[model samples]
Structures are given as C-alpha cells and as structure tokens.
Target: MQLEPGAVVEGRITRVTDFGAFIQFDNGETGLVHISQIAHSFVRNIHDHVREGESIEVKVLGRDERGRLDLSIKELLEEPEEVPRPRAIGRQSPQFEAKLRSFMRDAKERTTSGAPVKKSTSTKRKK
Candidate 1:
C-alpha cells in the first residue's frame, strides 16, 4: 500500500509511549502518532487515549527526515464545537460592577492624595 500523506488507514497500536503511540499497518509499516495529534483537545497522558493491541484509524501526515511515517488520530475525528466566552462582568453582574466602581474610586482617591495603597497581610501565630 502506498502510504502517502493525507491517506487514511486502519492499524493496530503496537506500542504507546509518553510522547506518542506506534501503529503497525497490515503491510508491516509502522507510524508514530504524536501525543499532540492523538486528540483534538489537550492530552495529559498518551496511555489514556491509546493502548497496545488496540485498533484505531489514523491519517498519514507524511514522513519525517528519517523517512518514518507521521500519523494523526485527531485528524480523522471531528473538530469540537467552540464554547462562547462569558459576557463581560460589568454587563452581567451588578455586584461585580459595584465592587469595581468602589475599587476604582478608592484607587483614584489614593492617587489624588499621594498616598501609597497598603495591602493587609495576616500574621500566623505559633502555639
């Protein structure tokens, strides 16, 4: 089989490492699916996504300088829907707006008065 870039193929997971997983094709060709290409989301552990002897579909992401195949599992998977960011605090929360306004006012007062703002630190007592 011609393992060209952009080709999709099914293979068996021969080994899983900290950085990536090794896939062995039916033709005895082996490829490395880097941890970054394992999932669309952040992958903290490669073992959690793939294990030895497991069968998975991977996309051929071309070969490296050493002529080894670089594959990706996330490329075959659909992209996750993006979540909209929360609205600004002042627009949504009145309490936060009030606190922000109070803080701004205090900051202005301190600046105008030429006084340095003092931060309170609690002292721990030893028994």
Candidate 2:
C-alpha cells in the first residue's frame, strides 16, 4: 500500500525506545513515532504507553523530506468527549516560574544573537 502523507493507519509496534516507538504498517512499511508525538502529555517512557509487538492505531502526521513517516498515536485516538473536571484554574507553581525564567533567558539570547527573525509584512488596508 502506498503510504500517503497525513494518512491514518494502524500499525504494529515492532520496537519501543526511550525516544520513540517503531511501527510496522500492514503492508510492511515501518516508521518512527517521535517521543513528542506519542502523547499529548509528557511521556516519561515509550514502553509505559505501548508495548513491543502491540498493534496500535496511529495517524500518519506526515513524512520528513527523507520520506520518513511521522506517526502520532494521540492524534489518531479520539479525545474524550466528556467535559473535563474543573480544577483550580491559572494556579501558579514553582515549575511554572522555572519554565518562565528559562523561556526569558532563551528569548534574550535570540535577541542578542543578531540573527534575522521573520515578522509580519502584510500591510493592512485602511478603510
């Protein structure tokens, strides 16, 4: 079967890695499901979610320029239709502060690097 980019498919988990899982399509095409694409939440380990030789449904998010099929299990699974339980919204934590500081540091470095950054160039037509 010709595996088109963005096609949804079901594949067998041939191997699992700390970084991602390798899947084999029914037609014998194999691809890697990047760790980041494995789940919506942070994935501490790939094996925790999928076992080797297990068949899992996935969406072919796309292929890289080299024709590597990028798979996503979370994208193929239907999200819970039930309303989410309400939690304390906007509650700040120490982790949030740490992440904010890290982002600011990176932003500062990028600004000082003298690298050209893309910006909106479209002129808004005035009425």
Candidate 3:
C-alpha cells in the first residue's frame, strides 16, 4: 500500500536509536521517527518513550528526496494540555505601582535639583 502524507498507519518499531526509531509497517515499508517527533514533551532518551518491537500509530509527514518515508508519532497524538503558570507571590500590582511611584518621585527630585545624572558604563568603547 502506498503511504501518503497525512496517512496514519500502524507499524512495529524495529530498532530504537538515540536519534530516532526505525518502524517497519505491515507492508514491509520502513520509516523513521525522530526523537523530537516521539513525544509531546522533550525526549531526553528515545527509549523512555518507545521501545523496540512496540506497536505504534504514526502519521506520514512526507517523503524525502530519496523517496524514504518520514513519519511522526506526536503528530497523530493530541497535543499536551497547557498548564496555567502560577502568579508571582510578592509582585502584586499595588506593590509594583508603589515602587514605580517612588522611583518616579526620586527621579523628579534629582532632575529638579539639577544634580548631574550618572552615565552608564555598559556601552562598548570604540577602538
């Protein structure tokens, strides 16, 4: 059977490598599942996600110039739900506004007093 892009197929992982896994379909066609395409989360080790002789469903991404099949497992799976980030405890709006107001007041005082503003020394010096 011809494998088309976007086609989902079942295959057995023949070998697992640090970079990717080799899957052989029932039709004897083989494709590679890159480490990045193995899971929704970061894959430090390919074996952590999939093992040899394991059956998996993968989507055909497309074919390379040499007509080799390029497959992805994550594409066929639902994306992981995003977790809500926790709000910073000590940085509430009122506290931040108060600090901003204080800084502005100090800056206005320095400007009104005609005190020379200090120059920043972070810029690179020209040769």
Best-fitting candidate, scored by lDDT: 1
Candidates sorted by lDDT, best first: 1, 3, 2
lDDT of 3: 0.89
Off by over 4 Å in 3: 83-127
* lDDT (Cα, tens digit) per residue for candidate 2, span 28-67: 7899999988766667777789999898888888889998
Report the number of the highest-TM-score candidate.
1
Q: Which candidate do you rate higher for TM-score, 1 or 2? A: 1
lDDT of prediction 1: 0.91
Q: Write the per-residue lDDT of candidate 3 for residues 1-127, one digit (tens) a residue.
A: 6699999989999999999999999899999998988877777788888989999989999999999999999897788697335465875699899999999999899999988998879678789
lDDT of every model, 2 decimals: 0.91, 0.83, 0.89
Itemize residue pairs with steric clashes in candidate 1: none
lDDT of 1 by residue, 93-127 (tens): 88888999999998899989977778897798779
